[model samples]
Target: MQSDNPEDQKSTEGMVDYNRNSAAQQQIIDSQAMQIRGLVEKVSNIGTEFRIVDYGCGPGISTINVMRPAIEACRSAHPGEKIAACHADQPGNDWNTLFGLVSGPSGYLNGTENVRTEAAIGSFYKQMAAENSVSLGTCFAASHWFSRALHLYAPNTVWFADLEGEARAEMAAFARQDWLTFLRCRALELHPGGYLLVSTLGSVPDAQEKNGFAASGRGIYRALQVVAREMADEGLINGEILDNFVFSLWFMSEDEARDPLKQDPELSKAFEIDTLKVEPAPLHQADLFADSIGDPVEYARLYTGYVRAFADSTLRKQLFEPSTNSAEDADRLADEFFHRLDGLYRKFLDKYAFEIWHLTVVLRRR
Candidate 1:
């Protein structure tokens, strides 16, 4: 059942048609296929049933990609074991779309025998499955989101990495706690010797950047800030809304991702970190920009659509809805906001290119 509370409702709304615009996520998953297969092959015990759970599986397009390797490996390692592939995400995610894709010809279940699929609706920060039930757990291109929208306001910036002073510290603390919660939840769901593979947006050190750290999607956030401020100045929206608006997400640095396990004894005992590394993720739009050298209009449209897919819901709820009185007015403002954002990308094609970095981690439940 859906929550009646507004905050709960807002927290549940996930990316809009995430599968259609998730090429970057697909790239990240494709790159990790070898690692995923290797990890799955290392599982020691063969049980009667093999369960693979995908946490934060938005729309199920990339979920299938992330799970296919594990499915194949598990089948090869322990043939004829009943396999269950489960996708978990927020309640308000595009479930219809996810289910449609899962049943389609291209889905992981299409050609596989003795395999079943299931959905668990809720936060990944909480357990979504029975204890010791999951053989493998995977989260890709998600988990950067906070458990809930933080009440703290960031007046100067629209993204976590750009926040400074107290605001940044507060956000970091919340992120650390959320990460531990996620690990603990997975620890409970995954059986002993089960594997958890995670790949999400991450931060890396850069002396030249602000806050002495560089994160993925910074350019996109920068563009959003610029367009939002422009709208505020033009009286399209209130300056106060812009001041209070910040994406409820955080990209953890390598140190941030590791600190909880290093500091918390319980977490340390729950899972042993097999691999944790940060590497640059491919920006699919950049390739398109290079290919469409003379067609900035097409490139801008594609890039803006990708941004809108993941960001439109947040902007609508947090920025436009509160800035306006009625739903109609909010919709109008959201349209105008994206229109301006698209125009900004068209004019400065090179400025908003995404430079994403991903932190890939493999953990074994102990």
Candidate 2:
């Protein structure tokens, strides 16, 4: 069910059609969205017209639904400056589905601004936003790609490199630079009294031995690699399946959360973080699905859509690699996963809990 409050638009990243398998993730997204909106509402320009821009807007469903209240409130309070919603996301993002949101009767925006996300560079954004075009900027859950400075989906060069550290450094540089770049771009876009709000999946590590996905922080991906490799050895799947998928995560101990900006000195130097709060909320497992279940496999399928979706992707990749056919075979695989999931539930009921780092950091444009 969509949220009753329209302000939910500010935190709509996780609502993408990417097949969230884990029901647990929805709560996290909802919690983080609320935090982001709460922080955004506190921005000094409450009375000012908002040129709202959703940085890294995913499907736009969540954003459109969540930001509704803000739009209506602003419309009620001051209608002089129209509400302009600028949605900036990656190049191949599903725009038809994303922008199609505007056709809805209760769309959260009065205007739509869509910009292809640059892999690392931020100059185009600066130019697209123009000088001082935005009154408010919002990004949620998507900043981690830049925060960790990971590789792009497709970089023009396709060159090979053997140095892992150099690659990591490059990724980090890209992340930090792009983060600062958006902040700069938004800063220039916002009027003197404008504000910017950003919220991403965050974590402050603790010694409590909480669950971090399973197997490893990269449990699903690493497990997929293992499963894929095994299937490949058995001549059941393609060896190149690995390149088609990528997943990454980051963790900062609670101490690190004390000053969230410390992770990126360059970004900190460029953008001043006015408010950074790291709050650990209990995983409301029941809130994830329409109804809760004790079985872990059912839990994964219903409660952990985010993780379950990834696992399903890997399984589908294995079945479809090189050759594709057999609707019956696909059905069989689905049945097998659910059946095995039942067994796995009996295997690790106590350790199945997923602990995510809920991070909230707001940066003012420099």
Candidate 3:
């Protein structure tokens, strides 16, 4: 499957073809922020000193934010107690950003030891000091992005490229690997009876739901394929549709989480998903998406609003424009693309209404 791996914000080449401000991301953060607090309350290591690993704690904002409440609650329930919180992210993750998240304690939290923060890349997966020592573990919306062994290429490479099929395949595989890795690691990291709290953006199955969850992947890909063909016909972009480009995402499940990850022999029996529970994480801030937004036109408007909210309008346009030489031009182009995208979304909304699922899975390590 084709993959466009953007490692964090800046690459070695110093290209910035991405947007930093993300409202959907912020919405996700806000939604999960509270349940994470509740997960902290469920943990009680009465006599033992506490240690935790926020598995796949991307960039550390979620981990540190969750940790803050946990630390305070721990103190309140067991007054004058010294608790230690460990924020874990892959070594390849952005540490500087994680550092910034934890540096500010803001008097609401005090008396908790930082417990020697460590970055765990793949090698860190080998072993850790927390051998069955962790009291609580949470992978908030980040487990499904892990690398896996079941890397299979779909049959139709040409069709895949023409339709950005590779991207879909990659995201699907990513979804699988993330669940497997999270459960497998949960088995190894948590002590018996400890809980693993996981939350993620999940795909709903029905055509209407799917069209709703990812309306743009297909429409946008169609447009790009046409553009690629046109450019190639005119002696530009080498007319290569098979180049690296794809669309994919793993979505919500009511039952799959009950038995999601494929059972691999390499995974220890002890490190299995002993019990799984899934429920929809409802959206509270309707104002973020409009209270009564259902019309085809309104859906398109909301969809485009979402894209523009997440992306810098200017950078997206640069992909097609010859004069897109500077960052300003790129932003302008992105804006235009999103402006036109409202029309594209209208096409999808006319056919199907989407159901975006926020999934929370509770895994008990075997």
lDDT of each: 0.82, 0.45, 0.47
RMSD of each: 2.5, 9.6, 6.9
Question: Residue by residue across 1-366, what tens digits does model 3's lDDT show?
Answer: 122443321111111221232334445556666665565566554337555566655564456666666666655555665555666654545667667656656322334453444455442233443567776676665543334222233222211222235555555556556555556656677776556777665544445532333321233335434434444466543223324222223443544455444446644445445334343435522233445356767767665554443222112321333334565654554555555556665664423223334666665555
lDDT of 1 by residue, 1-366 (tens): 222354563543767667767777888888889888888778756466888898988887788787788889888887778888899988887888888888798888787788889999888887899999988889987888878766567777798988988888988888889899999899888888889998988889999887999888888899999988888899877788678778888888889899988899888999899988887765543343456546889878877888888888888777787788788998999889889888988898868878778898889988
Q: Count the backbone clashes (under 3 Å) in each candidate.
A: 0, 25, 19
Candidate 2 lDDT score relative to the true structure: 0.45
Q: What TM-score goes with each of the models? A: 0.94, 0.61, 0.61
Best by lDDT: 1
Candidate 2 lDDT over 1-366, as tens digits, reads 122232221212223245234233334455555544554454444333466666666554655543554454445444454565566665445566655665555554345333122121122234446566555666655554422213222121111111134543454345445555555556566555455666554544334423322111223333334444454466544334433323332333333333325555654554566777555545642122323346555655542345444344324432332223565665554455445444443454434344444555556655
Model 3 clashing-pair count: 19
Q: Which ten residues in a row are the worst by lDDT in model 3?
A: 9-18
lDDT: worst 10-residue window of model 2: 154-163
Model 2: residues >4 Å from true position, as ranges? 1-16, 19-29, 32-49, 76-79, 109-128, 146-185, 207-270, 282-291, 303-305, 308-352
